[model samples]
Target: MVAGTVSGTAEWSRPRATHAEVTVGFGTDDTTVQVRSVTTTVANRTELTLANALVDTRLQFLTAGEADDLSVAADGRTRTYDRTVTVTVTLYAGDQDTETVAADVPVEIVVTNEPGNSEESGGSNAGAT
Candidate 1:
């Protein structure tokens, strides 16, 4: 993870994606507590903890990458279009006053393209005389 600066204040904002996909997590930290929630501000300050208050989740990103696209058949009456999906993970401290931390987590995004449908020809049954 790289130490950087963030600007904004949000209790629950969308995660940041690196190469199209967005993922959020903490830095090199490990804990046993489970994250309850996360909060952030325009200044890019995140705070998080655990609901149980036992241990910290120590949120952090493992890995991230791009996924494949979905495929669809196109019809003559309708048109085909391309679509994509991005995924990301966020680390939370599980505290109301705490903010959400961001890291480069592993994620996959899918892109799909719709194709046209094919027409069928008229035919008789083989048993028909």
Candidate 2:
């Protein structure tokens, strides 16, 4: 099985819709290899369910007071953080639940602070008075 990488950016002050290129695959191209379930370790961070896209996934950029500390780059203009997200998928054969395959893939999440990217723009208020 294989999974794609995830990269996202947010402002240090506000939240934004998370972004990522998520892809899941199997070793064998079996038509019956359907996905029974999909989950991620960043479910809470992304505020989303791996099940469907019905809900919104807003990201809270690496703020203060968290297990992972924020990294300041370019002299405090940008704050970044790295996180590992595990995407687990359960596959089953068509019309049969007994034959199931489970796979876990760890994807890295790099969230950096972008300048001027707010609701007004994207996530920055630098130009604001």
Candidate 3:
């Protein structure tokens, strides 16, 4: 998460994309509790965790490097993966005076290896269909 991006009285829902590779936020309104930020604490795909730059779910396609790192074979230079992630989310109260509550949220990660869809390209291997 950015230094000053998520530290303040949020007038509206502010989504913070942090190490979790998901938007974690804390905000509120008059009705039900609102969700702002979601941080993935654990992921099956460890390589795409905090050490990585790409956010979970947000990027539904794996770059060549990512596939190589995951050792996920590319079928016809294309492939897709589905994984689960454990995340922490914040629930905000309608009354700003009330302290924001933290909640647990589950996240699903899906990615398709599309050619020329990532930042860089290099790992080009063939896999059986």
Clashes of each: 29, 6, 6
Write model 3 residue lDDT over 17-117, tens digit each, in one string. 22232334322232222223343332222222322222332322233554344443454354333332222332222322222223333333333444333
| lDDT comparing candidate 1 with the true structure | 0.26
- RMSD, candidate 1, Å: 16.9
Error of 3 at 6 (Å): 24
Model 2: residues >4 Å from true position, as ranges?
1-64, 77-80, 91-129
Return the lDDT, model 2, position 102. Answer: 27
Report the Cα RMSD per candidate.
16.9, 16.9, 15.2
TM-score to native of every candidate shown: 0.18, 0.25, 0.23
lDDT tens digits by residue: candidate 1, 53-116: 2123333222222111122233222323222111122433332222223333222222233333
lDDT of each: 0.26, 0.30, 0.30
Model 2 whole-model lDDT (C-alpha atoms): 0.30
- Which stretch of 10 consecutive residues in model 3 shows the poorest summed lDDT? 1-10
Compare the candidates by TM-score and give the number of the best one: 2
Candidate order by TM-score, decreasing, is 2, 3, 1
